[model samples]
Target: MLSTESGEVNCITMFKSCLRYPFHLKVLWLVILLGCDSNLPHTNEEDQKGQTALVPQHKFAGTKTCVSCHTKEYQDWQGSHHDKAMQVADSRTILADFDSAKFLSNGVLSIFYQKDNKYFVQTTGRDGQPHEYQIIYTFGIHPLQQYIVAFPKGAYQCLQTAWDTEKKKWFDLQPDLDIAPNEWLHWTGNAMKWNTACADCHSTDLRKNFDVGSETYHTTFEEINVGCESCHGPADKHVTFYETNAKGTPPPLYMHNNMRPKELVQKCARCHSRRAQTTSFFDYKGHFLDHYDPSLIITPTYEPDGQILDEDYVYGSFVQSKMYQNGITCRDCHNVHSLKLKKTGNALCLNCHEPGYNTPSHHFHKINTEASQCINCHMTGKLYMGNDFRRDHSFRVPRPDQSVEYGTPNACNGCHKDKTPNWAADVIVSHFGETREDHFSDHLLAGYHENLERLHELISNKTYPEIARATAMYYYASRISPAEVKKIEKFLNDPDVLVKNETIRAFSQLGLGNYLPQIKPLLEDPVRLIRLSALEYVNKYEPNTQRTSIYQAAEQEYMTFMDMSADHTSGQQRKAQYLEAKGDVTGAIRAYRKAIEIDNHYNQARMNLALLLYKEGNTSEAEALYLKVIEQEPHVSYPHYMLGLLYHETGKNEKAIEYLRQACSRTPAILRAHYNYALILQQNKQYDKSIKAINEALLTFVDNEELLYIRLVAELNSKQLQEAYNTCLLLVELAPANPNYQQTLQEIKRNLESN
Candidate 1:
């Protein structure tokens, strides 16, 4: 073998010679490129096939101790992507051309170079000045690689500028978005900080150990990167069992080899998911929701038809798949040890699917073509970080109809860029017959359009997948009427935890405080997720002295969950909410402040703090905060609406109307902004504008009583008798029992008849 320096030089020379290929190949077969480590000991036949036939004499042994017995597994994992997921920057691991490589981005020149064998970059630092900083570590490998720069308080920020390994080019990961120097989205800001955002997923058994007092991180980890212990859990007890009984066959204990497939999926999901880690310590067991709060299939994150829209990773999509519903798991297709597909390409999928599925007849594509591939149609790939294309794991059928109706992308359109969605839909109809198969997307799309009947069916359907039903419930919960809320109460005891959890949330959203008795039972729920949610609702009730003991227990659990995740900005915000619920205004303010301190650009916390300040009669401070938020995040509509409310409260009607109009224009989807703007317009005798604004609001939130009332007032004031009559009829239809709507409808009818 050549010297270390010579080998690196040769590798660089080879890279220069090779043709630039698509990154998918390198991303898919990562293990093949990263050769096996020879240092791992060979496993004997006895250790290979059977469980370790020993009981531990001592306590937890590290991966090194297992190497002698389970050598094959250890060797397979040593050079895998997980093994190199994170590493200290060195000559051996660093992939970037750090030898005086220069890249100019948006007028800023960044220079990468090495001095005294230490990787360094001269780039725009936190203070917006050109500064030389040492690259502490290399994060991830293959398609692209990013350097981690260490900051004070044990914080590491992943630089936005990454080296595209496959293409051999330096590019900004977030190219389209230009981040200002002091902006939170900046590479040097809180958004890119590795300790809170990434370390837990990248390393094994990581504890953020964030000091709330000093606002510093004393992060610790059991292992540097994902290792044998990461998936297998703390193997001390298992190691003890093996060491003690070396001669006899032992049953699995800590390995969890006998765990249900769903349990195994949860174990993998802890890292694979685009989820919030609710607790610092994930037990590597139970449902993903029990440990981490998975992002729902919602707007901005997912398409209306539940297609992946953001860097949602996989779990959020996978949970909605037929495969997951049918007990298919990550291990079924992938080798747990090597983190590789058991079979290459179509063969892997074909193992479970019928032989007919692989043929042109089923796929309606020519043989040996890209269209013939199952993934190209079913699991459409989305390019992320410019080059790394990740296929959606939902494994859904091509729904060109949804694309035509909801403006969602279909796999057909994704591949056939030249063809319209209508053409794709027609082709699909011709091939597969006009009768489209019933899909969860239909209900999801219906929910998106505020179709109450379809949403109710989706939420109440026990046969549907829990994730799908839960997502439907979330959308339906948003605009539930008082009458519908009664029917929704029955789902609070849903068999599926997700369904029950969402139902409880929907109950809270309806503001139906009378339903507390129904929600009370869930405080003692088996699932921590449900119990915590119950605590949030139950704590809102006043002086429950009879149930004080159990309330304290539930509150303690909720508090513990929040404290475990206090390092997260959301966690701090939740704590603030909890404090506010308990009437501790000062504590809530401090928690909100801490959350803001942790993440300066956390708009929700700022909004919540401003609202709290406003409630406490600190009008000037609240107004200042709202203006500051508007200045920072101009696109956000909430601050504008809040400022509008603030000005209105201070009797500045003109300014209020101006801000409210801005809010309505910025966020057309927000029902309150439109309603408030229309209400103010009606008061100002601008009936035509008020009617127009109310119509816009009605499109998003149909049959809203307050909005309907405002619209009726606008129509009456403008002398639009027929429109006023129609509006009054809708109000009466929506709330049949309400005498106010009944009286208004009769009066409007009288006026219309006279006209």
Candidate 2:
């Protein structure tokens, strides 16, 4: 009785569920029906509608083609870091002094010297013996150039030894790092693996075809370095069309080049932002883990409260700024090719802002003075990684009053550390009087530090700008009481997606179960991130059963959305997360790999995949991945911790102790590393050193019950009975309600009585 199209649809549906055909065959069948046949009748009204596919008329112009016209831009880019982000190692590219310098770290000895002006390195092999290798590639050109030391798995970490171009001498990066004697200095150590980590982002068309069974990588790249094609799409068609056809005849083919400012920012943001990697490069849209997900990685890259504690360059902070909403692009204030500010100091601000606000009269400072500089006041500078000076890109106005009230630093206090905030505030008042007492200036000085009641007053005051109110709302959201949820909920419908998203984050933090019902509707919101936030809040607050129907529907919708658009970078990352959550490891790994294919800098995805590999007992593959992570981020601590664990599992206690100690020294997640180190020390029968590590663990984590028990055991094993008994008494008193604490206390008491 059904129509012809309905009959075919029914047959396909039956085939999909038949379990006879493979999944690929079923997918191919669906594609054939949906894409090829336009005459099919629609059973559902939605299926009847025709969707427009984006087809660009113009093609991409390769960098070489552009070079003919833009000689200046081309010349400026030739030797820059962006141009040489990846390069095959050679006499010209290799920078390390490989012939003269011999050094030892921990116990691993390495010798670097030059012969025939070619760099060469000799170091301990992975098998705890001496080995020599010629440098085949050099990755990165900046503060340092990392040399590729080839090994069985892949080209391992670039030696910590870098050629200081300006200084003209070899500099040891891990000067204080205690590497074990038997450990390989570069290849098998905690640092210097590039295939799984740095290659995806630093190179163009990088393919890390890791053989899971062999634990080796056939890493290859179409381009040795990031090029014009890295951001702009491949220009093969554009080149052909331009070379063959006249300008009037037909335009060249190209990827979407007419992106709005937001879209353009997202392209730069893909690498510049602090996000976790969701996939591998060979799998999907060319995304790499840790290099792609800005939100997940940025939080940890910075201090707990979101200050730039490390060297995370300003992408995340800029997104949170009002400037981002004002249609600002990275190119607006920076030279993309050179990767430098458009203009140095105050001149950059004068390009957009009128000189009126920045003049000495406006700033209440003497003209032509250092204090008169715009960055000196608005963007405070901080020192990181020993001597690297970086400016805070948050672009917050100086709030001397807030500095005094909440003990937070202000630009005024930053330059003049000896002066109190009160002094700075009094100076401003004395010079400018009430002229600068406007609401924005006032709030900047005190609103963020104000009580919830005061923030509420500001939010309801209508006289204040929405931007200021929204900023205050974000600050107050952390301390917002349950009663205030309704008031904040009103902003959820605000025209600004940023405001609405912030509201959702605030409500999520308040832990209100009732908000789940209200938030559930947002799962169908137009924005993908909003829907993600909604799902996250629902999962956090509402019970699984209560939110089951909504969760499943939302998840299915998100998955369908990902399937429909393979080019959306964030969508692919989310799909991987969803698959992983569903306990589909194989599917999740595939999705993660696909994300990396979309964007190669996704480091978080790489880390997750590595963890999964480690869990699956693929130790060699896991070790390679961990080394890659360390190469990308030398200062990061997770890779070292993972490597320590791997070494410990393989009975390399000395190597484990070395890496775990490095991890504990650098990262805030020190407890686990310390615990493992203590165990390693105990196994070596170094009782004093074991007690020392346990004591350090206790200093930071006194309330950790498991650590306390471990310490008690360490003390007993070391024959420190009196100290163990005393420690047991403290543990019992601290955790009187815990049965294990009581039992340990009784045992210690019996031991004391016997003694």
Candidate 3:
């Protein structure tokens, strides 16, 4: 799923998806239609935090109720981003060019105009025809504002053309795309749908009442925009306690009353971070991962070095920062109520960063210049959604050296665009010492290259962020050595929620094995994400036991969470995979199809569906599905590898060789591609070519047993008796237990002696 769930995942701060499983770990959610949770591990998010949830039945008193008591905070938030996050589509709120402005993007023309004192936009609708739709609402306020129009089945889509407030013009959020109307990423499609993607973060207490039976949303929210009750617990109890002065538990302290850095960051992370919603809406209770599973430092959202490559709001980046580790919160830089910087430029950084950092001697740049600014050097940003420029908050030191080696971005190249990365690296080395400080990205990049030693080191190292370590472990699950398995198994008891969640997930991939006893305890874990992973492991791998009630309850909770995001292809894909794992092939097939139907661009679903179809004896359709994935992603090796396997199974030897060759030539280095291809050649009596293939492949996969075996057979068939004899000897050494191999070696010896 690592497309960081590679295209297997994705979306926006306002999300989009497919059978895209959020690997870095974020996706859009539908509604979770759960019946009961009596036997479930935990009923509330607060169980993870050791607090009983108090606001489950709490009433919202509205922003008006809080105005009398906290006038300053209320006024500060009046026109703030959160207050203007969402608003009715009136002249006062609508900021786009409505005087019949014509904007063209790659042959698609979008016209913004108004009639009857209402804002309207004429754009390509779902059927690929230009349709005029009245704008129902405006989304967000500052750098860019998107328009929302209601559609059938409770659908609300945000227009692709957004008002570039700073430039005072209309621009397409996604540009230069020849998107078909049926495509998921089209402005009228599910990717741009506000109900599924944008509404959760933009509004207050959003209940995304998506009905799975009808595929509709009856979405409701307590307030129009993010208001007081959104962050601070529903104000009714707070107002009652204050007005009546009847304090028992003291209104369950406001989110920021005496907030720690961690608490403050988590509260804001609901909207700020790229994450998947596990429930209907954000409830002001429990751990962050309980309601949401946040995106980790995964690509294309994040570079391997944990630098921001995509629009990864703040939470994901901040959590990886040394500042966060050292206890820096959002409030330290910006006011909680106003959402404005407390200090400007270098001064804000100087509050914590040494004064020495501000001088040219330290920065090696002119004073008061953009290059000299702390943010430019450290918080290099990317321009996203056409014009919205958000900076990376990871606060990492510029590593030009790593950039030169890894092709990752660095602060030097961000400004010195004309200069090569090598030049930047040399310049950095000349200024700083030759030795760069050790960072997790180096190990992460190495791990991608099958560097097992670095991966093991990174996982064991607690100095790096737990998210990075967990991500490393996620990759390590497949490559893990038996000796190192116990080392990783120890992390199942890790206190860090992410590390433990990933550890359980890793072991689940490896199977329960001897760790079943250790893993069974995590079924009752405090964190929901952790418990879910643990439950998945025990439920799948463990033998029938007396804990049927406990198992079923956890299973139901898992299903309910899976059901929540069933609207998106990613959600359906996840459910499909889980069903497939549990031995429900028919159900899994249905779910996979549903996922593909959600988004045709969901190649993960296509690949999985194709695989299932082949297994189910529906070879023709499976072949077509494989072709469809190849059509969508011509360059990717996975679909090609699967197609090759299908051809091999069906005895289409020529086509099998063709695709296996393609698989071997691709970047992923399909593990058995060379062996499979050579086997087919040998089977087809192309002994010389089979020997040639194995000889070339052996340069890289020097000791691959299957490759060696196939080469031995090809050599024996072609009458290269001495070569075959040597190959058999190597095979015998590689696998002595195989009597077939033992007998074959003796036969080859006799043949060699005769020759």
Task: Choose the strongest candidate by lDDT.
Answer: 3
RMSD of each: 13.1, 16.5, 7.0
Model 1 alpha-carbon drift over 4 Å, by segment: 1-60, 246-255, 284-287, 481-484, 510-512, 542-549, 632-636, 703-706, 716-723, 729-755
**Which digits, one per residue and each the tens of the lDDT, describe model 1 over residues 1-755?**
10112112121112211111111010110010111121232222111111123322222246687798889989988878788887778999899999899998876789999999899999998888999889887877878888888788777788888999998989987778777787666878666778767777777666665666676776766667777776776677666667787666553543466777676777677788776665545544345565676667776677778888777778878888989989998888887887888998688898999989999789988987888888898899778877888889999999998888889999999889999999999999998998987888898798778777788888888877787888888877765655667768788878988889888777666555687788887777767688778887776554243556666666766766787667566778788877887789999999999877766767677777887887788989888888988987777666787788678767899998999888887742455667778877766889899888878777777777778887777777777889888888888888899887787778777767786
Ranking by lDDT: 3, 1, 2
Worst 10 residues of 1 by lDDT: 24-33
- How many angstroms is residue 443 displaced in model 1 relative to the true structure, after the best TM-score fit? 1.2
| Per-prediction TM-score | 0.86, 0.55, 0.87
lDDT, residue 564, candidate 1? 64
Estimate candidate 2's RMSD in Å.
Answer: 16.5
In model 3, the Cα lDDT at residue 511 comes to 44
- The per-candidate count of clashes, in order, stands at 12, 59, 16
User: Per TM-score, what order, best first?
Assistant: 3, 1, 2
Q: Candidate 2 residues 97-160, lDDT tens each?
A: 6556777666666787676756678876656677777666776666666566666655445555
In lDDT terms, how accurate is model 3? Answer: 0.75
lDDT of 1: 0.73
> lDDT, candidate 3, residue 184?
79
Model 3 weakest 10-residue run by lDDT: 1-10
